[model samples]
Target: MRHGRSPWMIRLIVLVLRPLLMVVTRRDWQGAANLPEGGFVLAPNHLSHVDPILISHFMVDHGITPRFLAKDTIMRARGVGWVLRKAAQIPVYRSTDGATDSMRAAVQAVRDGEVVTIYPEGTITRDPDVWPMSGKTGAVRVALAAGMPLVPVMQWGPQEILWPYSKRLRLLPRRTIHVRVGDPVDLDDLHGKELTEPLLREATDRLMDALTAMMAEVRGELPSGERIDIHTLAKPRTTYKPKEI
Candidate 1:
């Protein structure tokens, strides 16, 4: 597989994430080889807004440039959004455009053999304990459609640096981000089957289980048996946030 990362951009990322990481947090990443050179789905739980930087830093350090599906509003943000656009990250809908456009693009990227990173939970986990909650089927759809591997990745300790839905940053003592990558999810059972709602949920739950198990290993505790899907339960009456990647 051809490495699509630019040498100059890689050097720039290292120069940026290296010193900043040294001061902000320590990292423990396992299963680098789990991410193949060829196209694949990277499914990781969302912790803080800064989660991408840490994971992207690790991927670049391992010599792969990942493309993430970002919210359109985020793509229109001030400085960082500009950087995201310039780096060619894909954009998705928040309350505006439909999600079809982004999924089409991501599927194409996977077909072209680019490493596509997706946070299964469209929004950050609402799990009080920060365990991985339920996932939408977008990631699984893309992987199955493209005949690519769906890699399950879990990260702990980023929430310690910055909590969810908060603006506070705790860089005082410096934290260590525990990142684990598991083998490709077993989709062999679902392959060639019709893409029914039940099938999609099964595939998605398989993904969530893989992530939750790895997360349990990292934190040395089991995740909540009852998953918290904030999108469905948060309102339940009026509006439902679009199922997204």
Candidate 2:
């Protein structure tokens, strides 16, 4: 299960996507030195639907082929599903018993020396200012279970190209995407500890705090220090439309 050469399908996708990403976005990627040589969990803030492509571009350019924990619906699609399977992406069956299975697969992937990218926020930001909200415990759980490094990667500017849940693409401006990779989160003290709900929540908060701070450095604006909880919102998490400022 160790990481090997990229499959043909993944290579083809890189060929097609790398050029398009370069054309549409300028890169301000930093902290490649922070990436570990072996397996690790990549925890990034979820901004827009286009985040996977943008983050994958950064990982691939730096010689790491990231395996995402994608939704099962995407994994069940006709053409794209086939590619994801071939590329060894993990599928998440949300709200079902199979959800735990997805976490197991992700932990195994990390243990087997593959980079697994999980969006800790679980979905696009529900915050009106597009700041990262509170995170789910899945990413921290996977990293702790596998005993691997948990790297916090913050990305800004994808929302400028494509607003959250929007179908329209803003390709005219050629935005510059800012990506900053932080040092592996220090969980050495909690590595062998039991995966209790309180412990997991604490770790998730640390990861989110690191992400928000890195994001502030990228955007040069301070966050409000309060994270929005999707569960508290009246509107449905996935169906709520983005309000214009």
Candidate 3:
């Protein structure tokens, strides 16, 4: 467990951004008590690019340091890369480190007692309604591999700040970011079973369903039975796609 500059960097951001966000974004956080004291998975629906920062504020406030698995190419950027590296964020090597390599890193992060946040969909949801779409199996592998709980956390209103797949940033009116942290998804039965394809799909589906339900609760509406499956619906490729080494 290499302790990078995450300690000070997280505190620094929270010290500054927390207050600013308080004034700019109203918060509705529930089920925070469900967050375990040790290592765990903080899986959330992908709504905006700024979700990591927003959710970081939420988890950090609850004393959980978030470790996100990002793309390796994004780590080569001029400034953002530096911050990610400094904060010890995991970079998924889509074509280099192998498929399960990032999983290894994430498992290690969870074992190290840091909350690892994964977008089960692997990318932002393609659902036109901004609801939680489909999910991948990465989160399931990490949680089961590390023997940690997979906590479903959902957030709304970040789209109000920065709409998904859009460049326009609406920050004047101070939108309310509604984040609801729900109980950990029950993976005991699936975890004990063989890590098969059908089992993985079932596990990931349960995870996304939990998140989608939470989002519906936050919105006070019912979600559609059909959710967008990113792997098939719209392949929003990342900078570098991780492949098996």
- The candidate that wins on TM-score is 2
Task: Report the C-alpha lDDT of model 1 over 38-136, residue by residue, as the tens digit.
Answer: 888899988777788888777776777757898889899998788778778889875555787788788888989888888888777777677888998
How close is every model to the real structure, measured as TM-score?
0.88, 0.93, 0.90
Residue runs of model 1 more than 4 Å from their true location after superposition? 7-13, 94-98, 235-245
Count of backbone collisions within predicted model 1: 0
lDDT of each: 0.80, 0.89, 0.80
If the candidates were sorted by their lDDT against the true structure, best first, what order would they fall in? 2, 3, 1
User: Model 3 residue 121 lDDT?
Assistant: 81
Q: Judged by lDDT relative to the true structure, which candidate is superior, 2 or 3?
A: 2
Supply candidate 2's per-residue lDDT for 111: 95
lDDT of 1 at 81: 88
- Candidate 3 lDDT tens digits, 1-245: 22223566666767888888888888888888887777888899887878888998887777676678998888878898987888778888885656578789899989988789988887766566778877888888889889899999998878777777766767778788888888899998976667898888899999988998888777889866577667676334433222211
Q: In candidate 2, where is summed lDDT lowest over 10 consecutive residues? A: 236-245
After the best TM-score superposition of candidate 1, give how far the Cα of residue 229 lies from its true spot, in angstroms: 2.1
